[model samples]
Target: MTQNLGGILLIRMTSLGDIILTLPAIRAIRQHFPLHRVTMLTSLEYIDLVSEIPYLDEIITLDRRGKEPAETIRVVRQLRQKKFDLVIDLHGKFRTRLLSGLSGGRQRIGSRRDIYPPNTHAIDDHFQLLSTIGIQANDKSLEFYVTEANQCFAQELLNEKLLLGDQVKVGIFPGARWDYKCWPADRFAEVADRIGKQYNAAILLFGGPAEADLVSQVRDSMQADPILFDTNLQIGQLAALISFCDQFVSNDTGPTHIAVALGIPTIVLFGATNHLKFGPLDPMHTVIRHGNSLDRSKGNDMMRLITTDEVWKIAEGKLNSLDK
Candidate 1:
């Protein structure tokens, strides 16, 4: 709670969406401690993603997948050398907790999920941690900074694909990290076809290399020809491309949160997950859940329960609202 605190180290190791959700809190920390040296410790895979965020003074990334023991020791030594005055562990995992303890910070704070009610949004949960340090984060808005160069990259790709113009662009991401969280690909194609026919929107299919087959399935099943973006793109490139979309449709995945952070109008499909906790909180975004209850045991069946008509109706409403 002291204003004269030295270096502050914040840790959130892995997973893109979770890291994206923590941005508001990070911004709040920067605002609260403008004079202090604030550094973020994240996984190496997300360095490209977190690097663009202007809130942190420094970023330290670890190759979490490669060289396990050696990387851990190296990171521990690095943290100790920095001699952080305060260590805030946004990630409550054992590894982060251990690092926080070994960082030699005089004050240490870890996230306490029990302090808040069930189904609290991750952003609010993070703010609750900040409250412990007398840092009140009243403005909890997610942010992703896309540099002009990356924006130019996205524009060039759109121009090369002849996807430029005033026509509405709809981005469809038909892949989820978990199988149970994905709606059927055929259903996505049907929705894309309907949107293309009704709104005459340019369909932009997006996916990582791992989801190329899934993205292809949706594109192949669609009657309309969609611009494919299935190649491996850097996080900034992906965010820049997504920024061009007028409307985005995606499963429960990291890119969904990225779209939300970029202020795009997004429709997220959720299954076997707590939409209340992780779904977009802004009014511009829509979340369509499969069932009345949160039942992880239902598995992929929960996602299948979501009909094409259901999603189409919401998408129609959103597109119509855009006209107003």
Candidate 2:
């Protein structure tokens, strides 16, 4: 079959949560143009996870967190060589703008100007780059692709940790990249304790290496018949592990999105972010937001304010529904 477009380069190069959220739009694009070669520009750490997505023809990984200007230049040069037919700046940052300018694509699609104050829901502001091209984005729902390898890994991990005939596995994502998005680790431990004791479920602490400390803290704080699965694994492995859980409770982070996409009952704790805009869309998912709507600051200020009981109730409700 002939394709309308030669090739497309989509740039979304930051934040685990935001990158995961773009999958729905990516799926839409593939459905809209089946013959187009849809490539992605993302961080090196996420290469394994993104590669599992069948829609992506190729993935160009970069180390965007590096501060050196030469690093950006290196990626820009590589992008220029690809000579893509179109460049879509989904990230909409200044660096992405510069890269798109140098991409040598015939058409560059980007957002309108955004001058919002800091601490706003960055997702909406990023989409402003689409104004000039008349591409209006109404939804921010996330989608992910999990392979059978992931499922088998999850089961193996669970079986290794749990005795036969006791298949109760629960997931707890205890870390957030942004300080403001993280609830207190103790609160998570409290929830884990309750879930473990009441349901006889084993808690799996989920996060990358950066979260090992926080995960350890939560595991240590647990008081009620504590049994936890804490591992420093790759994102694909983490996703696989989460697939084995009966339910997942996490802060506003990437792994939570992955759990929801896998059709696992997930509870997302939202503190500094706006729930109206960035909440998960799955029927089995629950989002607990702070009562205050105008407090848009980042860090633990808002996250720390969420009461333990509030999260506990939401989590229990989801668990009950999932069990039924």
Candidate 3:
């Protein structure tokens, strides 16, 4: 049914990685309906990240911390003011469920649980939300657009370091919010040391302030010299740096999604979390899983398992085979 075109609202109040992964759907929506005003509901922290993305006409921030009913009601009221014709509930949470239900939108799309076998993959499951609107799924790749300004900024940084032309830069993301997802800092350092020595590539460590200690630990453990970018880099700078990277090795984090979306070859380490549901969807990316090191102490699930050697081999293979 060709519903009368009007404003579209997308509800995906997830972490940075999940939001990054949703860019394909955003692009598809924008391309499909060029004139429609497309808005997104996401975390307040990610406002800058979504701002750099071109397709969004408006972005509504929902601070998930202190998630009071009043805050949700305020969001609902704001959404009501927007007068969206369709609300695509990518989050499918109770909050989004309520907001979409009460926002007065004509079509409210959401996900179904049984579409794929358990742990199939998140992108596929996320696409299920599209099905509610009669939108058939296809093999659409993830999307990320790096503006020329960001690229210039990245290049300037590289140039200042005198490491610009013909040098391969690799990104390592040692931080995943979940402990099950993070490979050991020592293991990451070992792999980085080996790869850097073998390929003469500069390894740039990426993480946020919370992971500053982990970054320091990895840097201290590394035998090969590396550039530690552990401090908080804005989403644009991070995107720009990832674009410049010849390849990226990361845990199942947002930067991994960003790397894949930017068309960079990435090696992702997955544990605890279901790889089938959340694995990277790009051909240029490969996922390595080991025994579940994730335990309650680590702030991750205990059932999952993966080893360091397995991830090292995968990272080695992907980095070695990277297209120049």
Candidate 4:
């Protein structure tokens, strides 16, 4: 097949949730240009997760969090060498802006300009970029490729923790990157206990090393015994574990997005964030918002306004539906 374009470099050097949400549009771009190799320029920690994106031909990683000067120069130099045909900046941040300029692609597309479109989801923001180039982004589902090895690892960890039963495995992620976005850990524990007792389900706490303290807060507060997923599993393995969840309840965070992509009935607790823009893609999934919208300045206390009972009802409804 004669290639229409040399290659495409997609820049999305953001944190977990945003990066995961960008997948569908990225996939659309790859599908639009089947013959061209689609590459993603992302953070080093995200390399494993992005690698699972079958549509992407290659992944370029950088330590964006650490701000490594030499690494940036090396990556930038290599990107210039690749002589990309198109560069898409989904992050729309300063670093991605710089990369978009240095990419040397014939056409450079970015998600945002001076202001965003009046009302749109964050995912659509990426799709809007494709429209400019006459490509309609028809696919809007989140994508995550889980390997057999990763699945096996997840099962083994579950078994080791004695969570390999027919009982429902409710995965809970209590921490979000930002304080404003995180619901209280104690409330999550209360929800876990309610679900565990009401349905005879096993609570599964999912988080990283950084989230261990937060995880502890939830676990210790809970009356129910939860299988703590605080191990050093690779990003792929962690997602694989999430796949086993019957229903996931979480703060507005990356793992919540992962659970939603896996087709799990996920209930997201939203307060500081806008539910209209960042809520679940599917109607089947739930997002319990505060009575009113709040800004970051409103503080995390607003999240507490989202009652445990209200979220419990939504979660129980999902679990009951699963039984039916």
TM-score, every prediction:
0.97, 0.85, 0.88, 0.94
How well is each residue in 1-324 modelled by candidate 1, as lDDT tens digits? 878899999999978899998998999999999999999999999999888889888999889786989999998899899989999999988888998998898899998666677788888999999999999998878888899999999999899998747888989999987777888999999999999999889999999768888988998899989889846999899999999998999988999999999999999998888888888999999988757566666758888888899889989888887852
Write candidate 4's Cα lDDT for 35-119 as tens digits. Answer: 8888889989888888788888899988866678888898989899999988889888887898889878887888774567645
Among these predictions, the greatest lDDT belongs to: 1
RMSD of each predicted structure: 1.4, 3.6, 2.9, 2.1
**Backbone clashes under 3 angstroms, per model:** 0, 7, 13, 0
Query: Candidate 1: misplaced stretches above 4 Å?
Result: 292-295
Write one digit per residue (lDDT tens) for candidate 2, span 1-324.
224467888988776667776666666566656788888988887887888978789999887566568877788888888888878877777877877898888788864335544444445555454444444555655556667786677677667765444556788888877767888989999988888877777777766667778877887898854445555676777887777678889888888878877778888888866665567765668887756554556446767767888878877776776543
Model 2 clash pairs? 110-129, 111-128, 111-129, 111-130, 112-128, 112-129, 180-299
State which candidate has the highest TM-score.
Answer: 1
lDDT of 3 by residue, 1-324 (tens): 364679999988877878876776777677767788999988888887888778888899887779787788888899999888988877767867887898888777765555556866666666566655656566567777777887898888877767757777889888887665677788789878877887888888888768898898899999877876637887878899889888888887888888888888888877666666777766668877654443446423321344556666776777667666
> Which portions of model 2 show Cα errors greater than 4 Å?
1-3, 65-70, 112-141, 163-166, 225-227, 293-299
Error of 4 at 307 (Å): 0.7
Deviation in angstroms for 35 in model 4? 0.5
In model 4, state the lDDT of residue 226: 87
Candidate 3 displacement at residue 310 in angstroms: 3.7
Find the number of clashing residue pairs for candidate 4.
0
Q: In terms of TM-score, how similar is model 3 to the real structure?
A: 0.88
| Residue runs of model 3 more than 4 Å from their true location after superposition | 65-70, 112-116, 291-309, 322-324
The predicted structure with the larger lDDT, 2 or 4, is 4
